[model samples]
Target: MLSPFDAHIDAELAQAVATIAHLRRALEETSTPGEAEEVLDLFEKLLRDLERVKPTVIGRTRQHGASWDAVGRSIGMNKDAARKKYNTNNVQRALARIQDGRPATPHPQRAPVHP
Candidate 1:
């Protein structure tokens, strides 16, 4: 059984997915340039939000013993790609958080096992 926190997160994710689907359909059906641009703007905002959240989520996963290979598998990418894409941003953001006196995600206590 899912914990309450997990359930709430799952529900929110589902709702967000549903909303995205609705927006995609509306975008596809748009006939006028202005309407299409409006839909595209909303889509761009969603993409921006995802970009902002991605590094933090990656950092959280690392703190919780997730490996780059595992995370890559989950997202359909290779570990090298994952690192190349996010590691610098992750380090920079973490440093900024620390400098700001905020508790950033903790680093893994042990190195990940290699296969």
Candidate 2:
């Protein structure tokens, strides 16, 4: 499934698109190279912002209800692609131990096993 970073990137991509649209409108109204360049730079920064957030989604995609399918939807990912990329993607090693058809929530009293 899609990761947390993937989810975040999905959200950021929408924001980036909106930001670009706004800048485009502004550019058409003003038609200044300097201003256009400035907006383009901001666009680049948003792209970088997207880059930074994708990894966070990727790192947090598995847990309880945080299944691959859920992760993929959050990140606008196709199910097959998300599965292909992250099927073996491990989230919490501790969670793996309790995978015998058990609930995934962790209780502090029930200490996690050290691998």
Give the winner by TM-score: 1
Residue ranges of candidate 1 with Cα displaced over 4 Å: 1-32, 88-115
Model 1 lDDT, residue 65, Cα: 84
For each candidate, the alpha-carbon lDDT, in order, equals 0.62, 0.55
lDDT score for candidate 1 against the true structure: 0.62
Over the full model, what C-alpha lDDT does candidate 2 score relative to the true structure? 0.55
Best by lDDT: 1
- Among all windows of ten consecutive residues in candidate 1, which has the lowest summed lDDT? 106-115
